[model samples]
Target chain A: MRHSLTLRIGPATFRIGSAWAQPIDQLARLYADYPDVDGAIADFTVRLQPTSAVRRWVRPSIFITGDHGLADAAPMSLAHGLLAAEMGMNLQMALGWRRHLLLHASSVEKDGRVLVMTGESGSGKSTLAAQLGERGWRLMGDEFALLDLDSGAILPFPRLVSLKNKAIDVIAGEVPAARMGPLLGATAKGDIRHMVPRADAVARMGEGGMPALLLFPRFGSGPAERPVGQGEVFMRLTQASTNYVALGEPGFAALTRFVAQVPARAIDFPSGEAAIAMVDRLWSEIA
Target chain B: MSAALLVMALRDPATTAALDATGWNSLIAMARAERLIGTLAFRLEGLGVPDAVRPILADTRDDAAREARQAIWEADRARAALAPIGLPVILLKGTAYAAAGLPAGRGRFIGDLDILVPRDRIDAAADALVAAGWEWVKEDPYDDAYYRQWMHELPPMIHAERDRMIDVHHTVLPLTARPTPDAAAMMADAVLITDGLYMLCAEDRVCHAAAHLLADGDLQGGLRNLWDIHCLCEESSERQDDFYLCLFEKAAHHQLTAAVWRALRLSHHLFDTEVKAYHVPIEVDYKLRWSDRAFISRLLARNGWGQETRKALVFAFFVRSHWLRMPPLMLARHLLTKWRKGHRPQ
Candidate 1:
């Protein structure tokens, strides 16, 4: 029942498991048009069976099976689609963590250092990261950035900067030849997303870069881009960070040390253009 | 002494039966060990509590007591490192039990340290902990978003290297409740010990505990509230009247009088504590509206209600009390706004 699907994230090729053998072949054929995908990992296997536990909040239209179990059981509803996507993303995060320190951040490379941009999802993190990546900066990751805890270095696990709605047009307009992945039907947030792969991500697979700066970016409807003060940055970053309290003494020490070594900034941009320009300036300074 | 005797006398056959069935001896033994460690904590430093309670410390035979003690020591070491940061490390609940000269393992079993810091300093606190080698327990994007957007506390952070866990609460209430008495005010009212950590005043602690019990509505939290009320009232006997009045004043100040009174009444009835003297000035009909008489009758029947009636009464009172707390006009306005915004009526 186990089947594999190769996903090219950054330069690394991860083979994903499908619970059934047939759909695995289907997915392989689906992506057969792309030649760059290297190899995949058989990490997950899904199944479809009649059980009270799997009963419909909604009945699915497409019943695709994978080596892991079921691929997209509930294909019709936006809620189910989001659930499936989240489940897949979670699987990737779990697998990725074993190989590297998976940070809850969005990242772009400046000079040799990775400028990690972290915020809650919908803080326009992926959009900003994608914009930076488009400006020739190496994209480390648009969702989670893998960091080496011991060395505080970021390892690239770049894939597509998953853009939704207007972001798709923005990215497409910016990079006309960018390949579009499958357009997921719909999501709770909006229509759906498929992203253009970051070229740098494909080139620098498994490569780790030192984490240079941490920035918390917010897009406001103002007229200018401003660098928020250090104290303000510290407060915002702290509020935004996960595991701040759990890290206890050592966690706090690591954060202070990390922040001291790297410049932490809160960038407020009025528009996407302003955001891209500000990041470009930061990239130049760091380089 | 009389209050303790009274608590001892009311111990019903059913109470004893339940306790015995649940291995109360071992639980008490664990509690006693924690109390012993609590005594040790005070002896090492007069962090809080009077010296008189120090002599009456009990003993325990439970192995979990040892594990709990080791955890306490580890936390103490971690607290020591954090003390120099000038932020008050207010040890909460189980840690407070140990620091306040009670048996460390006495009250309830605790898995890890629960500490409170000013919400503003939470980040700084995290940074300090990370430098000491603690790793985050789990990292998820949605979890980060949920904590940042909807929660008052960051996700529960566990030490990567040790068994210790720290729950950093920025606000005592959930974001949904929108409880008043902002973090700054609470921090301003905190009592700083010589060890450099602070403790919420008894008033705030009681209110916080009450809010938590009401929001969670579990048996254990109810039991804990009963224990806290009994302990705080008994231990602070000299200030008992003052404390009760202050508790009422503080609850009213925070617009939580209804929740506090409801929780107090329920805890009193459940534990057979004497609380009839405390009075609410509002008339029952005016307060509860539709079910005023029935609710009042049920409150009176607290002495002999069957388990089902007790449960129903608790739920009824909880709903009624919270409803009473809300301004009827505002509730109507909110409903109107929801309707205007195209929210379908359930």
Candidate 2:
């Protein structure tokens, strides 16, 4: 608890405490534009500390702990401490948070309507959402899509878009250098760098948008579009949601309403350009 | 003062109305950490909160309510599974409180289902539970053997599809423990709440809570258990004479008179649990006098955050828990084996 930072993202707030100042300093600089929590209390907490007293100086590894933590997760090196802190915050929200139906998805909004994309790793949802933000869409969130359980709206959580491996270079080419955090190399998930969201995204983090479309995107596949049914979407979203079971009936009702209202498609594209084109075509038809 | 605020709020709702957003947040966080959010939420009903803090409390209450509902379903499912096999499942602790509609169960969170059958019927019941799709929680040979041999219960079993666990206890304490409580007598005194479900009678329930708090657990997480005793005592205030007498008889019968006496004294000191005059026997009074002083400091110091300031006291109590359970020789061997296994390479 040496150095700490508080970040208010959309509806939830996180207090991240660190034993070392390096990770805190990096987060403060990267998240400078995000708003502070309205109240003194943060919804979730993340602690990044040395695994032991001696480990503080000797090849320190960041041990993540919070209200809700995995029992036997291994520690991350101090070099990846920032990522550890971020993951810790996400884990707390996914497991402990109850106000919203949390979906492990990325979202971008246009004209008060949001499009959500979810899939497994290497699905290109994060990369596509980042690319779309550069063009005209307002990046709503990358790591989690906060679905209002009662209102059926997508609350904005535009934290820094975490770009890993080739996606870091791809986003770097489009976004200016000043907006990028230090490139974190040799992370567990490959080289990861964070891109500060567009100024508008940070400014409008409190805004909520109605869901217009849901996309299950697959990368490295020949271009094809298939409509997803309500039942399939329900099952897939349940799998994607972290606290759906904990939230029980309320979570089920909210997700059921969302699937009934939103049009879903599984789009497979070989490259980013084709993915964008396919999204555009689907948007036109849906609109 | 922070440590007392949550309990005070639950005892009196007006205390919460004066609290600022920060106070409410800390209280909520502490309640969540202790798994007492539903209890707080239920107690706060009709007592207004600030608009900013209302949503947070509402969300917490919803989650807690969902959990409580699920607990009821689990108990029903457990009955369905075990009833046909003729093992009498006497619901214990949280599930028992909730199922029997006791005051202590309102807005409480039930983790795993605990049921007691006759000691001789333990194996037959375990087989029935397995036949009903509950499998041993631990596949490790040593851990499985440890529970089966030294422990009172089998290794906890989880239903294959539901993932809910059932701790099948034939008795309250481990078999190797110094005090071997007469499980048959306790079962005989059980009151029939319904045809299949039974609960420990009022005095027996109070005694069991005391024993579980002071004798069974390490006392690190006994705050909730102490609260259970407090609520049970308050609920049966009309029968205080019978309750106290029966509590004493059960404690003496189990040879846990000291443990039960300490539980009552602490509950009275901490939560102002009411008891008749001179309830503490003169013999146990000397032991409890210094214990009361030591525990007062440690218990009062614990805030919304966990109790970490009194590490020595916690450790002492932990060692005492083991010492009470097993003789010195067996305890040393058990501790050694545990330490070696823990240090062994994975």
Candidate 3:
């Protein structure tokens, strides 16, 4: 690792070392507002390494590696180094983070209450979370909603909002040009651009709120809503979580608490505006 | 010389509680690299760690518990599946350790369920397993033929509903391997756990672990393999005064004297496992060989950063593993065949 940067992302601190300076430079710029992490022992380490020594200079590709890694993970071109760094950090958290009941969901905080949204790829959850951040909701996170095992509080991660394809334009419209990252063309998940959350999201990252609403949002359809059953919610959440199984009995207990306590709904929307409206309506109805 | 941080921790787990952040970091990384995080987790249980290290340790510990439970459940399912085969179903390796409540099984990660049947009964046993919903994971004809003809086990199979895997082995080593242990005699001496389930006796268990470590594989999970030998020897030696005498006798019978001897010395060197914990001189019994130092260096090839050092040594051992398994001609053919099949033997 010739170049390195360390930053605290909410509950976890990551030390990212890289073969090239580009990824570090991009990450330093994007995560400029993160907490001071000088000489901090990182919770996890991420390294952007070349697949081989000669390969480093040949094609100049990057293998996103860390404390935990997938042996057969494919490499990415240096052009998507920022995306690689993000993936590396996310990979570490997904595989290793255990203090929280981590869910593969986006969340937003309003009035010290949290609304978590989860869906499959292209379900507009990222777009919705990014949209809600500008339209009065404090974006808790756009990738993972960290639920404290003991407290049930939805801890704010709010790293970078990964806006793919059409969602890039949707988020780019609301945020200033400075907040938007460079466009990554033709990735595995199609076109992607990372957007920094609003300053408030970074400033109040330490603050966490009790989860009030859980929504399974689906894009493509015009606005429709259904109350999701608890059993269905539990099963879906288990599938959604990266470390639910790793957390074992405590994870089971925490998830059960979440399913029992939080009000859940499956939402459908054609666009970001409709999803936001549906979220607001559901939040109001929950109380 | 001081052992690697992970080895030191395994030797005395309480010592880690006093380590600074740097020490904990190195220890954790090494443990993870060696796939011994779960074992460390159990050892570090009840000891208070730094707040930062708590979650990491706890996480792996929980996961290890889940793994053990799932492994045991898989073993039970395997037992039920092979019940009607009308042959002895003896558990092997990790499943065996856990089934018999050995220290090696505590916090150990068991992957696929392994069972042994007599070489003659293997076909019937394999057929019964496939009938019992163990679907063929390796559907390729070459792999199937390779396993049936050259290897000791059937092509690896996965349970259709449970998604778990079971590798049914007639013996530990390939047919072409130089050392052909009497699998039938070993099976006859197997200790029964339940009505249908069985595990290897202490001496045979040590021999198998050593064979698997020094003779069978590329030392991929060598640290874990070494740990198994250490614990097995320590526990067995304590239970019986003439444990080493019996062990050596069995090792020679299995044609694994060199492997077992190197295994014992390496375990003693790394883990401080006492062959004379009961006050008998065991080191004096077997003279140290110069080649033992090469393996000692090879075994401790991991640096403080958990990175695997000694690439040449690694490659040499890999070649030796294959060399031990088959003659040069067959080895060349196998490697070429694997290369052509897109599973490059590396």
Candidate 4:
């Protein structure tokens, strides 16, 4: 490894090392606002190295290895090294993290209460979260909604909001140019870009809030809203949680408390504007 | 390294209170890498951990406890599957430790279900397992043939519904290996811990663990294996007088005198495993003194030491493991085949 960097995001921290300096340099630049970790003990580690010696110089490909790497995962080309590093960090959190129950959802805070949104990959959760962050809502997290296993509170992660495919251009049109990293093309998921979270989100990453509402959002559909039953919520959240099975009993208790205490709805919207309006209507009704 | 410190603390609870946050972090990471976090959590349950790291430690413990419970359940499932075969199934390694309620199994992670049947009964056992919905994990013809022809265990079988693995072994080591221990003798000495469950006797248990660590396999996770030897030795302190005598006698019978002696020396040196007076006279000078230094460094190094320094040492140990397993002609042929295929058995 030639270069390394460590960043603390909410309760979790990451130590990432790379064979090439370019990825680290870009990461340092993008994550300049986040706090440095306390010490050498990071929650997870990510290593990005060339596939082989000859490949180091000749059309180099970056292979990822770390404490939580999958045994047969394929390597990404050096051009997508940053994406590979990001995926590696996420992989560790998804597989190894145990202190908190992680939801593969986007979250935002309003009036001291957190609203969580989760969906399948192509759903407009990231795009919606990015838009809401610009519109007075404090972005709590993008990839994971960290739920404290003890308190059942949603801790803020607020990492770079990954905007993919059309979402990149959609968010780009709204956000000022400086907040976005360079556009990455042809990723495993398609063209992707990372939007630096709002400064407020980074500044207040330590704050955690009680869960108020859960929304299962579906994009490019006729605008509709339906109530989600408690049983359905529990089953869906178990599917959404990366550490649910590993956390075992504690995870079950926390998730059960969440499903019972919080209200949930399934929302379908044809566009981001319609989604935002529906969310606002829903929030006002709760208020 | 903090890993070594964690092992130390596991032996003594008072040492944990003094560990700083950085130390705790490193210790936790090392424990996770070595698959011993649950073991540490169990050992430290009553001890006072620092406020900052206590929650994480508890979480790790909970996770490991779940895994241990699952392992027990899977063992029960395997027992049911083999019950129809009506043969004495000898549980080996981690499964045996857990089943026999040994200290070494307290927080250990059991990977696969390993059982030993008589050499003549292996085919029947395999047939019973397959009939019970256990399918061969490896689809490759070459790998399947290789295991059936040369290896000690059947091609690992995975229960289609349960998704757990069962490795049915006729003996502890490959048949072609240099040390041809009397399997019949070992099985005859197995103690029946519960209905239909058996474990190797204490002396044979220690010898088999040593042979597995030093002679039969590469030392990728040798530190954890050494810890097992340490616990097993400490457990036998009550019978210290006969422990070493039986250990040596078993070692000699198995042609594993050198392997057992090296294992004991390393365990004693690295972990302060108690060696009784009777065991003190065992030959330690037969192995190169320089090799001792290399093994100590390579085994304890936290990171993968590259090909030049510690990596070379690991490679040498790997080659030696193969050398001990096969005759020269067979070893050469096996190495060439493995090298050409770029595949090493997991």
Against the true two-chain complex, what DockQ does each candidate achieve?
Answer: 0.01, 0.49, 0.47, 0.41
- Chain B vs. true chain B: TM-score per candidate: 0.62, 0.89, 0.93, 0.89
Q: What's the TM-score of chain A alone for every prediction?
A: 0.70, 0.97, 0.98, 0.97
Q: Pick the candidate with the highest lDDT.
A: 3
DockQ of candidate model 3: 0.47
Could you give me the TM-score of model 2 versus the true structure?
0.93
Error of 4 at A245 (Å): 1.3
Error of 1 at A286 (Å): 6.0
lDDT of each residue in A71-105, candidate 4, tens digit only: 68897888887788888888988988887889999
lDDT, residue B53, candidate 3: 77
Per-residue lDDT of B79-174 in model 1, one digit per residue for the tens?
A: 775766776677666556545544323434455676777877888888787777666665766557656665667777777766577777777765
Candidate 2 lDDT over residue span A104-192, tens digit each: 99999999999999998779999999999999999999989999988999998788888889888888999999899888899878899
CA lDDT, every model vs. true structure = 0.52, 0.80, 0.85, 0.81
Tell me the deviation in Å of residue B131 in model 2. Answer: 1.0
The CAPRI classification for model 2 reads as acceptable
> In candidate 3, which residue pairs get closer than 3 Å at backbone N, Cα or C atoms, i.e. clash?
none
TM per prediction? 0.40, 0.93, 0.93, 0.91
Off by over 4 Å in 3: B1-3, B14-18, B276-288, B303-306
In angstroms, what RMSD does candidate 1 have relative to the true structure?
Answer: 18.3
Candidate 3, after superposition: displacement of residue B140 in Å? 2.4
Question: Model 3, range B282-334, lDDT digits (tens) per residue?
Answer: 33333347887777667777743455778788888888888998899988998
Best by DockQ: 2
- Residue B118 shift from truth in candidate 2, angstroms: 0.9
